[model samples]
Target chain A: MNLMMLLEMASQGFADRGAVQNGDQRLSYAELFSAAGGAAGIAREAGVEKLAVLDVSSLAVPVGLFGAAWSGKPFVPLNYRLTDAELESLASQIAPSLLVTSRDRVGSLSKLPDTQVMERDEFLERALGAETPTADWSMDPDEIAILLFTSGTTGAPKAAVLRHKHLVAYILGSVEFAGAAEEDAALVSVPPYHVAGMSAICSSVYAGRRIVQLPSFDPDEWLRLAREEGVSNAFVVPTMLSRIVDSIGEGAEAGLPGLRAVSYGGGKMPLPVIARAMRAFPDTNFTNAYGLTETSSTITVLGPEDHRVAAASDDEAVRRRLTSVGQALPTVEIEIRDENGAKLGPGERGEIYVRGEQVSGEYLGRGSSVLNDGFFPTRDAGSMDAEGYLFIEGRADDVIVRGGENMSPGEIEDVLLEHPAVADAGVVGVPDEEWGEAVAAAVVLKDGQDASSQDLQVWVRERLRSSRTPQRIEFRGELPYNETGKLLRRVLRTELAS
Target chain B: MGQLKAGSRLRSAVCDTEVMVVAAPAAEVELSCGGAAMLEIAAARSGDGAPAPDAAEGTQLGKRYVNEAGDLEILCTKPGQGSLGVAGALLTVKEAKPLPASD
Candidate 1:
C-alpha cells in the first residue's frame, strides 16, 4: 500500500481522534484531511506541479505536506541549516515550480525565481476558505513522494528520493518492530527533514497512537515530558539518552512511569551507557536503531530483548551481538559484499548492502544509483555473523589509512567506549607524515567522573593492539555531533589540526 | 530612506515556517546567547512600510510571530532590546514535523 492509503486509513479509522497536535492547535483526522484537501485546492490554483517546501518544522507544514502529496508532486524539503552556496546548489538542482513557506518567514531566501510564494497563513486561509480541489489526484507506487537531502555535514548533500512504497515499508516495519498499540503515546523531537523524524510521525499515526511533539531536543524538558505525558515510546540520540540517564540519578527514580521504550540512534551506544540506562530504568525497553537518510530510518534494529540478553551473559557472544547492528528488519534484505561487488559469505567483513522496498535506487544528484543488481551500498564497513547479524565496522569515508594498515574509527571508538569512565567516544585519523595517519580519540567522561587523557590512552592500549590503540587522546566535555547523534570525527580532526 | 522593498524573494530553502520573523544577515553572527530568548527583528513589510494586505484584518501583529519551538502564536511587536533587557534574539528552530508522506 502507498502513503495515500495510510492517510486514508487514519482518516477513516480515527476521524474524530486527535490526528495532528502542537501546542495550541490540535486537529482531528477529519479536520486535517479536509484542511489538506483545501490546501490541495490552493496548490492547484497556484499552478504548483512540483512543490518545494522551504520550512518543514512548522504546524502549517503538515498541511502543505499533505496538500502537495495529494497534488501528486514529489515534495522536496531543503535543509534550512545549510550554507547559502549549498542552498543555492540544491535550489538549482530541484528548479521547483512553487516555493511554499509562511508569511512571517518570507524574507530569508538569498536566490530564487519570481515564482509564486505561498505563505503559511495565506495558504491556510485559502485552503480553509476555498473549495477543495476537484481534480482526481492520484499516485502510482513507484512515483516519488518525498525527497530528503543528506546532512551535508561532511561535504555537499545528496538528495535521497523516497517513493511511496519506501515510506509505507518504513512505517509498517517500524510499527511492527516497536509493537506499538493504540494505547501507546510517542514523544517525537527529531527534525522532520530526517528520515527518523518522518518515520516516527508516520508509525505513530499508522498505529493510531497519540504523539506528544517537541519542537526540538531539550534534555531536561524531554524527561519531564516523558514523565508528565505518560509517554511510552520516543526517539533520541545516544547523547540525549546519556543526558536523560544522568538527570535521573541513582536514588530517586525519575518519574517515567509510562515510558516503556526509548529508541536510540545517530551513533553507537557505548556498552557502559547502555548498562547505565538499563540499571536506571529496567522497565524502559531501550532499542538501538541504525539507518541513514538514504534508507528511511532503520533497516536494522537491536531491540531491548537483545540488550538484556547480551548484558546478562558475560560471554563474548552477547557483547559481539550487541556490537553488531543486529539482524536486518523483517522487510529489508541485507548483503555483505567485497570491493569487486561480489557477495560475501556470512561471518565475513565487507561493505553492508541493503535491498528492499524501503531502499532507494538513485540519489537526486551527481552520485550514481544504488540499483546495482538492486542493492544499495551503505558505504559502511561491516561484517555479518554466522547467524546473519550485521556489525558496522565504520563508514568507508571514515576509514583512516596508516603506514600500511587501515584503521577504522569505529574499532577504536568501540574500544574506548569499553572504559567505565568514558560516556561517549569518537576516533579520527590525524595527519602524520611519519605514519601517514595516526589514530586520535576524543572522549567525554561520565558525569561526576574524571578520566585524564593519559588514563584513556593507557586504557585503550591495554585492550587493543599497540598499533590499533589511539596514539593521542583529547578530553572534552562532549564530542561534536550532528543532530542525528552521529559523531563528527572531522571536527575532532580539525581540532587536532588547529 | 529609499522606498525599496526590504524583503527579498524567499525560496523554501531559506525560510523556516516555525520561526515567523527571519533576519538572515549577509554574514554569520557569532551568537553567544543560549536558550530561547525573545528575538526582535527590524521587520519591514513587503514592498512598503505597510504590512501585507492580509495583515490588516484586525489580526494582532503579535500573532505574526509564530514560535515554532513552543508552536506558540504570540503577538510580537517591535520593541527596543533594552526594554526587554535580553542579550540576543536567537531563536533555535531545531526540530520540525516529518517530511510529507508520498503518493
Candidate 2:
C-alpha cells in the first residue's frame, strides 16, 4: 500500500527509462529509485517526523515524495509562493521537519526552531552519497502518505490527509502500470504544492512516462519546452491554457506536433478559450478534468472524444456539454443531492456528492466528514443530465439567491462568454435592498473588441430569461484568478457588494 | 478460511505467486492458487511446493485475475510460475479498460 511500491514497480519494470527531467538534467528510473532510497536514509538519520518541500518544481520533489514514503512519513509540500510569515507559520506547524528549499532561502528557513533546512543541491548530493536504506516501508493502508494544505479562498488553510490506500487506489484504478510508451513525456508546469503536481509525478512514474518539469509557467516557455523535449502529454490549469492559446494567437502555427494529449483542470475553463485551444492544437487530444484536493485528483474527466463531439455538434445540448465536466470515472459514483441529503434527479440543481475509495474527506484536526453511507459532500453546486454529464456550477456558497430562487452564476457567465466580444467573465451575487441578492458580472473583452454593458445584458436576456440577465455589468481589463486558475468570486462579490 | 477483504495480501504456499485483494465477496470462500490453499502474507509458510499440472499456467506481474462470478478479484503483486484460482476454478486475466491519462 506504500507509495514507494509504485516507484519500486516502475524501477523494476523499466529501470532504464527516463523517470524525471528538469531543464537539461534527467534521472532514469533506476537512478530515481536509488536516490529515493538514499533520501530515506537521510530522513531516518535526521529523525524527522515529516519531510517538507518549500521550493518550486525540481528533482527534489520526486526524491522528497518517494523518500518520505520510503521513510514512512507524510510528505508536506508547502506553497513556495506564500509570504514569508505565512510560510513560516505552516513550517512551524510541522516542526522537527526536514525542510528542502532553494539555496538562497536556506539561511532564513534554517532559523526556525526544530527545523533543518538544506539547500536542494546539498540535499541531493548528500542523498546520492549516503547508503540506500533497506526496503522497510509499512504496508498499513491507514498510514498517511501526504498532507496537502487546501488552498482556502475564504478561511485559514487546513491540511487534507491522503492515506496510502486512497492514493494507491486512485492510481491503480485510473492509470495502468507501464501503460505509457517509453517515448512518452509529460510536461508538468504546476507547482509542487498542488495535488495535480503530486499526482502527476506518481501517475507518470507508474505509467512509465518521463516527466519534464517547468519551474514556472510561461506560455511561450511551455511551448518551447514541449517542442524541445518532444513532450507528448501535459497537464495545465485553465489559466495556463488560456495564456498558451493567446500566445499561439490567430493563424499562428502551433509548432508542437509531438504533443498528443493535453488535460486542463484546477478551475472552470472559459468556453471560448477552450474552443480556441482546440483549434490551436488541432492534432492534440484535449481533456477537461474535474476534481478537488480531497478526491486525490481527477474523479471525472471530459475526455478527448467528448471534446471533439461537443465542439462539432450543432445541437445546443450537445455543444453545451463542452462546459460540463463529463461522467464519473468507473471507480467513482457521483450523485446530486438536495439540502436535505436526498438524491436529486437529473437536471436538478443540488450539491454534488461523490463516493469512491480515493475520496478522503478527513481534515487534519477535523474528523471524517464522509457520511455513514460513504458519500462525501463536495459543497459544489452542480447537476447531472439524463446522459450522466455533470455540470458544475460555482461553489454552493456562491449561489446567488435572488428573491428566494437559487441562481447559478456559472449559467449567467456561460451566456456572457458566448458573446463574441467577451473573452473572460466572472459572475457574482451582490447584496441588494430590494431582493436578497442581485446578479452582477465583471467581464474582460477580447482584444480590439468593443461591447457596451447594455449589449451584453441583451445578449444574456436573448438566450436566457430576463431575470437571469446581469443587473450590474462592469467592464474590466481582466477577472481575478488565483495562482491555480480558480476565479476569485469572493473577491468580486466583496468588491461589488461594497 | 477467513473472509477476504480489500487490502488483504495473500501468498500461495505452493508457488511463488502473491496477490493483493482488489475486490472480494463478503462471505468467506475457499481461495486457492495453483490448486493449493492461499495463506495470508503474515501467516504464509516458506515453501516451494510444486503447482498442480492442470493449473500450472503462470501469473504475470501487474495483471488482475478475477473469478467468473465477477466478485473475487486480485492484483498480481509478483509474478509466479503458478496461476491463480478459487475452488479449483482457474481465474482469468482481467482486461484493463485504459482511460485517457488525466492527472
User: DockQ of candidates 1 onward, in order?
Assistant: 0.01, 0.67
The lDDT leader among the candidates is: 2
Each candidate's interface RMSD: 16.1, 1.0
In terms of lDDT, model 1 sits at: 0.64
**Model 1 over residues A1-498: C-alpha lDDT tens digits?**
245445555666566766666666676766767777787777677775666666645556566666767777777766656655666677666665566664644665534653456676676677667665553456356667778887765876778888776776666444531234555677877766777767766676666666677776777888877777678888877777777777877544665757788787777776666677777776777777788777877888777777778777888866678776677777688998887889899877678888876787568755546765888988888888787777887687788888888767887888877787877788888888799988877788877888888887788778877887787887788788886667777778899655
Candidate 2 DockQ category?
medium
Top-TM-score candidate index = 2
lDDT of 2 by residue, A259-299 (tens): 99999899999887888888889899998889889999999
Clashing pairs in model 1, backbone N/Cα/C closer than 3 A: A54-B12, A57-B96, A102-A120, B62-B74, B62-B75, B62-B76
Model 1 regions lying over 4 Å from their true place = A83-85, A102-104, A172-180, A250-252, A345-347, A447-452, B1-103
- Model 1 Cα shift for residue B5 (angstroms): 54
Instruction: Give each model a TM-score.
Output: 0.77, 0.97
TM-score of chain A of each: 0.91, 0.98
